[model samples]
Target chain A: MRGAVMYAPGDVRVEEREDARLVEPTDAVLRLSAACVCGSDLWPYRGIEPVGGATPMGHEYVGVVEQVGGAVKGISPGQFVVGSFFASDNTCEICRSGYQPSCPYSVIMGSIGTQAELVRVPHADGTLVPTPAMPPADMIPGLLAASDVLGTGWFGAVAAEVGPGKAVAVVGDGAVGLLAVLAAKQLGAERIIAMSRHEPRQRLAREFGASDIVTERGNEGVTRVHELTGGFGAHSVVEAVGTQESMMQAIRSARPGGHVGYVGVAHDVSLPGVELFFSHVHLHGGPAPVRRFLPELIDRIWKREIDPGKVFDLELPLDQAAEAYRAMDERRAIKALLTP
Target chain B: MRGAVMYAPGDVRVEEREDARLVEPTDAVLRLSAACVCGSDLWPYRGIEPVGGATPMGHEYVGVVEQVGGAVKGISPGQFVVGSFFASDNTCEICRSGYQPSCPYSVIMGSIGTQAELVRVPHADGTLVPTPAMPPADMIPGLLAASDVLGTGWFGAVAAEVGPGKAVAVVGDGAVGLLAVLAAKQLGAERIIAMSRHEPRQRLAREFGASDIVTERGNEGVTRVHELTGGFGAHSVVEAVGTQESMMQAIRSARPGGHVGYVGVAHDVSLPGVELFFSHVHLHGGPAPVRRFLPELIDRIWKREIDPGKVFDLELPLDQAAEAYRAMDERRAIKALLTP
Candidate 1:
């Protein structure tokens, strides 16, 4: 099987690797149907995050179960399934509390590298949610999106408490942020503001239900959000960029008693405790418990109620994985879908 | 009028000040019945927080409305009332949202000096909540407690989402934290863990319905909380100490989906964003918004359902304000009430 691997900064290649197989009693081997490059992947690609050696890449996928371990239940061969980047036993106390990413027995799906011809998933019964039926080819991208981005965006909206009559502000223009706008809209937010200066991203944001757009950044952006909301900042803010500036903007852009749902992978960020305390805002975020929203997302995708797949602006064969990474890294593509 | 003044570190004196009068159409002059020294006041008294020359001290007070401004509607002269340290117009958008302390027109009651014979309260109609009747002399302490500590503790418990079946952990042993234990108990928390090493405070905590007491500090304290909660941290954590160590302990002592309500006035503290993000805990807090809980707290105190005033271990004439501050500063008294 050929899989994407990174040897060093800006060094990505598609190479032959050992075929994946069921490794545990609760494992399932999946035949990859679709995989994609994520913005987070750019961390190591751009050398912002160090790479030890050759590392298998990719964690988002939607595929058919090719083989199931003897101990696996519910999931079986020939079933189309979607799984979160984090494989959780869904029934644990933590998972039951809707924080599957922090589940004690969870496994990182990225380690298995879903961007390959074949991949092995552990805790199959708990990790994989099967579709009601084999999804059509046109639904593949949306299903793949549900594996992480869509569910993540949904979690961000839920964490921010975006609801009816809420004025929600999104602080990033990435796929997750755009999708967050969609999620907030779907969650019944009365007004959705997308902070973006990029034309293309801004357009997508509007299409995703953003009622307004602020082309400013940092403090100016926060001021604009406040100005748009009558001097009281937005009631709910979704922070998809984990930089210090973005986090502060998100925190500062919320009104007192507001909520901030931050999903960005934080880097070298320290929040001034005094400001956060005085902000009087509720803050909750992390690597989203994507597994918690997979089922509902899959249903919405199946019903064509949402087209999160639109986030993938480019698609290529799995053998062109390096190009996919480059396209996403260079901002040439919002996201790149790979087909094996 | 005579008031407590902090001229320098450890220099507290009873001195003459301007007599209180209604200056604004919405203001009221209150003849203070009782004023208590707060843990926060120790910051400046101990020189942790800077003090300007001859700063009029004290913000916690229970009193009788001596006069009402022309615009004051709800409150009347001769009424026994309780007000938060921050006076807000209660009708503003922020106040309506239950964050009165952050109201656009909010005024700090301490600036007028509550530790005096008479003090002017601005926005009287919105800031003061009158008791059902003049609270009996014996109930004055409890009503005074509601003016700040009890209300703050109750806010912390509510912010922490304390409810039936939830395990609550308190991160301070101060009067506010002890009252938080009481608040959690009243909020229906099934188990309350008071983090305290002091024998008297621990005993008071238990009397306030603390089901367990963990004397360990920092990481070790978090470990004890986890051990007590089946290796998962408590469901709710109230952070009543603003230090970095206490903040981290409070965050670390909560389960993945737990809530952390922090109310201590944060000093030089900055929370690492990455750690907070990955904590997967809901964090909300600030200056307590005591006005939000004043009514209920006053009612509870009046009915003798809760005895939060028991936290005051010392009483002195208003002229001995210096001694009152010294006793609280030296920890010789949990709290000291001053009567004029």
Candidate 2:
């Protein structure tokens, strides 16, 4: 099987790997149909995050179940499925309460990576949401979107309580933040503000439902949000950039009693206490419990109710995985979809 | 009129002052029946919080409405009233959204000093909760409790979602924490754990409804809470102290998806981003919008359903305001009430 691996920072390659097989009672072997580069992957690629030797790369994918362990229930081989970056036993107390990311017996599938010909997923019964059936080729990107980005963006919107008559702000211009703008609009937010300095990203943000755009950074960005919100700030703020500046910007852009849903994969981030105390904004966000929204997202995608797949402006053959990483690393592509 | 003033740290004195009069259309002059010392007062008294010379003190009070401004409606002269430390119009969007403390037109009564014999209350129509006639002399303490501590404790319980079948943990041993114990019990919490090291406070906590007491601090305290909750921590945690240790304890003591309602006036508080992000607890707190709880609290106090005023362990004549401050500052009293 061919899989993408990062030997070190800025070093991505497509190479032959051993076949994947179910290793646990709740495991399932998947034949990857589609996989994509994620914003978080840029961390190590840009030397911002430590990368060990030859680590499996990618965590977002839609695939067909090739094999299932005996203990797996509610899923079987030949089924098309979308799974979150983390495999979770949905029956755990935490998972039952709708926080699957923190599931008691969860495993990070991102480490093993989904950018491959075949991948093994644990907790199959809880993590995989089967599509109604195999869909047309164009639906693949949207279905893959459901595996991570779309669900994550939706979680950010819900976490921020973005809905009817509410004002929402998106703090990142990446694919996830652009999708968050779509999500806030779908959730009925009256005003959706996107913070982006790039013309291409800003154009996509507007297409996705952003009513306003603030190209300013830091304090100036916050000031723009306040000015747009009658000096009270937005009713909800979505944080998709995992940086100290983005976090503060998200918090500062919300009104008192408003909610901040931050889905960014925090890296070397430290929030000062006094600032948050006075901000008086409700803080709730972490690695999103993406599995919690996979089922609904898959349904919406299959029905063509949302076109989140538009985020993937670059596509590559599975064998050209290195180019996919390079394109995303250099910001030439918002997201790069790989066909296996 | 006479009022309590702080010339410097540990220098509270009783001094003659000009009588309070209605200064705005919505203001009302109140003849204070009672005022009390607060834990927050000690911040400036002990110089933990800087203060200028002869600053007026006291924000908690139960009093008689001696005069009403032209715009004041519903509330009449001679009505028994209870109000929070911060006066809010309670009609603005922020107030209507239940964030009265941050109301656009909020006025801090602490600035004017309710410790005076006569006090002017702005936004009187919306700030004062009129009691039924004269509350019995014995009920004065309970009514006084509703002025700030009790209302704040109730807000904390509500913020933490302390209700039937839930486990609650309190992170302070002050009057507000003890009252939170009572509020949790009233709200139907099945288990109330009070974190206290002081013998007297522990006894009072138990009396107020704490089913367990953890004398531990920080990680140890969280471990004790986990041990009590079958290793999952409490469903709700009330933070009555605003220090980093207390905040972290409250956050750590709650299970994922649990809520922390913090009512303590934040002082030198700072939160680490990663810790808060991973804790996954729902965080909400600030100077509690005590006005939000006053109506129901007044009813409960009037009916003698709960005697929250028991938190006040000492009483003194208004002229001895200095001694009352000393008792609380020296830790000889949990709270002290001053009568005019």
TM-score of each: 0.99, 0.97
Q: What's the TM for model 1?
A: 0.99
Among these predicted structures, which one has the highest TM-score?
A: 1
lDDT tens digits, residues A85-172, model 1? Answer: 9998888899999999899998998887988999999889889999999999999999999998888888899999999999999999
| Full-model lDDT, candidate 2 | 0.90
What CAPRI class is candidate 2?
Answer: medium
Summarize candidate 1's per-residue lDDT along B1-340 as a digit string, tens digits: 9998899989999989999887999999999999978899899998998997889989998899989989988899999999999999999889999999899999988787888999999999999999988888999999999988999999999999999999999999999999999999999999999999999899999999999999999999999999999888999999998999999999999999899999988988899999998899999999989999998888788778999989998999999988988888777888899998
Each model's backbone clash number? 0, 2
Please give the DockQ score of every candidate, comma-separated. Answer: 0.90, 0.63
True contacts kept of 2: 0.57
True contacts kept of each: 0.88, 0.57
Query: Which digits, one per residue and each the tens of the lDDT, describe model 2 over residues A172-251?
Result: 99988999998998889999999999898899899989999999989999999999998899999999998999998999
Once fitted onto the true fold, the runs of candidate 2 whose alpha carbons sit more than 4 angstroms away are: none
What TM-score does each prediction get for chain A alone?
0.99, 0.98
